[model samples]
Target: MQNKYVNKVLKFLKWGAFILIILIAYTIISARITGADPSFMGYQFKNVLSGSMEPTFRTGSVIQIKLTEKEGTEYEPGDIITFQRDGILITHRIIEKIIHGDAVTYRTKGDNNDGPDIDAIPAGAVLGQYTGITIPWIGYPLGFASSKLGALILFLIPGVIFLVFGVHYLRGWRLSRG
Candidate 1:
């Protein structure tokens, strides 16, 4: 009876891990193919690559950004937003809002920085607002997993483990039947 319960628990965990791995793989592949960040349920996950936002969120932390439509979304001075600049995503707090008739721009600054950024970001360049949900220190592993070699190792280790476990289970079953 104990053995049966243990097997059931292990099976449950195995499936859960498999699903998580598939999700991660999909996210990486889709981003590479689309040339844009993938969003799940209106939220995009991004990794912090610098200490600019330190004290608020450290480098190597993963943050969730809530995707919003550019037309209707309202931004203020205190809001932290993610924007694309020269093909790179940057997260910073809005220091000021400049309005020119119907046009709008934002002056942004990192929380730990000494001065605001040199260029004002057009409203259309804004990607999403930071959701304040961070997973500390997970970005390191995530960054690795996105690489070709790292992804191969990630999937290979699990495949080998599952293969070994399957063989062991089959052997035990055959012995019991005999």
Candidate 2:
């Protein structure tokens, strides 16, 4: 009787883990061939949380970013780009780029923003351009989970439930053998 549920759950876990592993491997291989590595540190997500780039990108968009800047190519004005600012990820358009010998300065602004950004963004601040975004509402959960409360709910609750389920599953296996 209990063996049936145990078998079902174990089988499900096996297949689920197998599929997840295969998908992850495939993603890694695809990234390598495409000249990118698509994983984040500590399983992070760099998402576009605001409507700063409208008519093209909306709020609740997941933008996969690549670290490590490419050199020798000067990004020009009107090129969309993403960059790290104070450790946070930001994506905006380059409205101006001034090349002074070895130094490069940039001015960036959001498309939907009223005016250009108040500050002049140096070339060092730019990361990369807007590559892609997931579906609108579908990415909301992801963006939300990156937040404080949502992180707790998304990670802690599921972790606790999985632990409880694992214990119950092992207990059932032991009881069945007795």
Candidate 3:
């Protein structure tokens, strides 16, 4: 009976460790492919930051995203969208969309801001149109988590598990050999 219980525990530990490793690996890779920080974003961010989006989106809120398909999607004058400006992320509503047969340009402004963005939105720069807004503070915590920290956790989790498993497996093998 004791041997059976020990066998079950060993099986559980092995599978659990494998699953954890796979999860961590996927998380890091997916984040990398998306050009986003794994900690706060996954393909898309949940919360919107900055007051520039006010009435449309408040600080500590969330927004949806879709990769710009084939250049840029159709932009309506009032559609909310997120784009990176000089490496900084920003979300604003489009006041006008200029299209000239395969060429698309956008003029954007914040619902609460006094003026429009000094620069025009490059058609190709748009991430996606925000279908809706969400209220969540998830972005703040994600911002705190860094890739380095994720790497540390990825290695640490496996190391700890392997150490524990190694000890347990060795003990089981010893008992069986005896």
Predicted structure with the largest TM-score when compared to the true one: 1
All candidates: TM-score: 0.84, 0.63, 0.64
lDDT of 3 by residue, 7-46 (tens): 9999899798688777767876887799765442324554
> Stretches of candidate 2 above 4 Å error?
1-44, 70-74, 84-89, 138-140
**lDDT winner among the candidates?**
1
Predictions in order: lDDT: 0.90, 0.69, 0.74
lDDT of 1 by residue, 29-117 (tens): 78789986767888998999999999999999999998867651389999999998998999999999998888889999999999999
- Pairs that collide, model 2: 82-128, 83-127
Backbone atom clashes (below 3 Å) for every candidate: 0, 2, 4
Worst 10-residue lDDT window, candidate 2: 36-45
**What is candidate 1's CA lDDT for residue 14?**
84
Model 2 residue 45 CA deviation in Å? 3.7
Q: What is the C-alpha RMSD of each candidate to the true structure, in Å?
A: 2.4, 7.4, 5.1
